[model samples]
Target: MAVSAGTVMPAAADTDPRGYLKIMKAQEMWKVADGTGITVAVIDSGVKLVPGLRSESVLPGVSFMEPPLEHPDQQYPPHDDFVGHGTTMTAAIVGDGSAGGPQGLAPGAKVMPIRTSIGTPMAFAAIGESAKGVRYAADNGAKIINLSIGGWWSLDKIRSAVEYAQSKGVLVFVAMGNEGDGNESANPIAALPGVFGVGAVDLTGEPLPSSSYGHATDLAAFGSKVQLRCTDNKGWCVADGGTSYATSLASASAALVWSAHPDWTANQVARVLIQTAGAPVDGSKRNDWVGYGVVRPRMVLLDRAGDPGAPDVDPLAAPAPAKTPTPSADQTSAAPRRAESAVAESGLSWQWPALGAVVAVSLGLGITVLVKRRRR
Candidate 1:
């Protein structure tokens, strides 16, 4: 499932400005589980040890981006947050606000960074890189995998890798996309079975326009106007709010719950998050807009509402019905579209947009952030 290193490329940045800790009420949850002994694998661009992150909070991980063989005797560390996107994600999950910055939801949690690709608005030049990255993280002792970046591509290799991680009791959280449409084809990784597809919401718990919606959408978090420090020290930057930030936050929240109850399986943690999520508007039990609702990990930590279900059971699996339903016209016509989407995933017909004004432009930096993942 490993892809060649040549496929990784450059992309853009995004953000908003706000104190997410206060909004999510993370202080209350900290009293119970500060996420000690938990490891979150940030499978994005490489993560650097930024100003606020301590040496222990960030750990070295593998890189699918192959290094040049010419430097056979040289050592290359996969710790460079080249485009700063990965650094932003790591900060949101484990930052301690030591350098006058926003604190992470799980300050005591460690981040194991795996660089599968580089830059914003980038795609998996080799789609199998994502698959390999997932497997590598799980095998290396990561309980939760946070993918703040995604694309329309989905390889059989990637699906198998995700299934493998699930079997090992690891939770993988992926961004639901930012196209403002519920197009599963646009963000194929989120459609995989057993993965938790996360979307974005505002402080008031309203879904953002860029947050994609679909059956894959499992949970939502405050992604709009989130504030954190940048790798270059140009000051704190605000992510314009997309599913990328939300997915990272959701992953950190899971670490808190997991750290509190070391014996709970991934299924039990997932069940607790779903049961504790704040109810959304339209409230039809479940919908494509925001799935279960905004993640409320505090409810499980303080209220002790996270009842560990069957250790081996998956809560996301639909119950078996007495009979199979007949295929409707919509279902019949969807076959051709699915085929078309498969073609799109492998092709470069779709293009991403440039970074917005809010994302601080690096001086002399030649990166052109595109419209994929959660930034668009």
Candidate 2:
């Protein structure tokens, strides 16, 4: 169930009031690269030209869903979405904050909206539609493909499509899931060898219980209490927790890194991200709960950390050393402490809400959480 929408709330004057940008040090990273010359294909329901995305930030793309008869005007095609899910994802990656909308992490980058059906009880044809979207994005000029949708099972068509994109040097990122438990075996796309399986964490840097985890979990990012611009409101809504948002951030992070080093290969960019990520408190290379710790693009953009290994080397292809889980830290009170300590050490202040004050929002209408399996 990756399509969980946040409750509509009063619009904020700016995204800076929220902690997501500050926690990731987005402002600092933007000084180096604003994602220029990068296009991230968002494969979801569709993308609407909201105020934040009004500029030429969104590019024309194909749609797999049949056009509704009522709105058959060729001028107004499938790029318009009634559901705000796709729009929200677009905003998270490249929204320009026009007219008080949420600002994107990589505002200078462009997005290609690939419309496809992602509602629950999804028809078998939906898989074909998604596969087609992936292939189309790869054939086009998309440097990165973002699939925030997930399903319960894996299929060859989607796997072949993902492989096709990877072979073409396109980086694909998928949501681990929002099952609220550790059983991520049900959703396989995130487990794909080359695709980045992103997980979520709260402002405190602790892993969200709802974020699915397993061998496929490659990296984690701030996904809880994230601000987004949805069709439900002219303003903004804060998604309580969903790997979909985390996946968007991960894609945006890649855009920032790629924009700064446009000549780097896809494998090189992937290598830098994994290498610069904050390691687990136990000092293991990675773990099931938070992968290689939270993504810290600033480490690469500002501090010049991480060596982009061999261009031809697929980092995930080699088996990583077995993770030594810190039972006391990862599973209990120690996790939050470790996160806070790390933040303090980095000289970053993260303002997280008190645990007692956390409130879950209601999902918007037509926002269905779908799960998909990986090709492995």
Candidate 3:
């Protein structure tokens, strides 16, 4: 889940990111737009059904967060938001009202909300349960599942859940992370095998330092100073400036493309975004920051530029083939240089962690001794 930067940044920072509304561009891109019947699964913190954004586009959602501790409130239902990120994202993807706020990319698409965002470092039970939520969406009929959360450490349940979703032909997208620490800390859900990791860019199309970066990142999108309706419908809007927001933008883009071509598979939709994405990188190469590029949703739908081949294959289905990823010359045999200081060279007051795995030997248990004994 993302934290709002409203207080940290200047007031104008609350304005729309990516420069302009770009609604006309979005409309042109969604030339074949029609999402009247499709259902998208947004698995995040509970989404408050804001009245201005068209309550009709949303189906009843389940809340595992609201508590009498054990039993949930069946009458009023629990879709209220506190952090304001999830609500903002839901509206960005599904809002259909003419209230003149942030209209969704695929307004006709129906959103099915699932609350999985619990307290920070989500309980092991919640992490385990979150995976179950994805399976529930898959068993039902959600064509796409958007995961916009990640943490410093990995959760085994989520990795398995992503694999499960893919097998069922559900497209999964995740926020790489907001750490901005680059290689220092690997965010789990985004780094997991099956997820299409997303990063963030500013209004000038510059990469945000706060956005997580890695080869795991498959794409990026605008994430600075974005304006959208408040998740709680508090009669005010908040600015979007996190990779969490970027993930929602990317997810909605996929829905538009999917809606236009109902016959295509998740792999095909992924290929389109990967091919036409606009990251101003050198030689069409990917970077640690922006991955393939910033997603151009309209490009995939309008230019008819992406190729949708082999519906049977999930685009991100296979684990990266072994020995296929490019490697450095000494990758198999070199000992990495030790860090200059165990302090990790950061000014953020973090001490050298107690659990450090510093390798001291090239091989374990003296393998050659066994070979010599066998020869004797």
Query: Considering every candidate listed, which one attains the maximal TM-score?
Result: 2
Best by lDDT: 2
- Residue 226 shift from truth in candidate 1, angstroms: 1.6
- TM-score rank, highest first? 2, 1, 3
Error of 3 at 33 (Å): 1.2
Off by over 4 Å in 3: 1-24, 66-78, 97-101, 117-126, 152-154, 181-184, 228-233, 317-376
Instruction: Please provide, for model 3 over 1-376, each residue's C-alpha lDDT reduced to its tens digit, 9 standing for 90 to 100.
Output: 2233233332234444324236326656555774655677777665776654677877776654434334444332337655444566676677653443456767888777777534323322344545777787787788888766554332676777767787788888777666653222324566666577777765445666566555566777766665454423344344544676677777877887788888888888887877667743443355555666777766666667777777775555544422213324553233211111111100000011111122111111222121101000
lDDT of each: 0.62, 0.67, 0.56
- Model 1 TM-score on a 0 to 1 scale: 0.76
Sliding window of 10 residues with minimal summed lDDT for model 2: 347-356
Flag regions of model 1 displaced more than 4 Å: 1-18, 67-76, 120-123, 181-186, 228-235, 319-376
Q: Encode model 2's per-residue lDDT on 281-323: one tens digit a residue.
A: 7666777766666777788899998898888788787755474
Better of 1 and 2 by lDDT: 2
Output the worst ten-in-a-row residue range by lDDT, candidate 1.
340-349
Off by over 4 Å in 2: 1-6, 13-17, 66-76, 120-124, 182-186, 229-235, 323-376
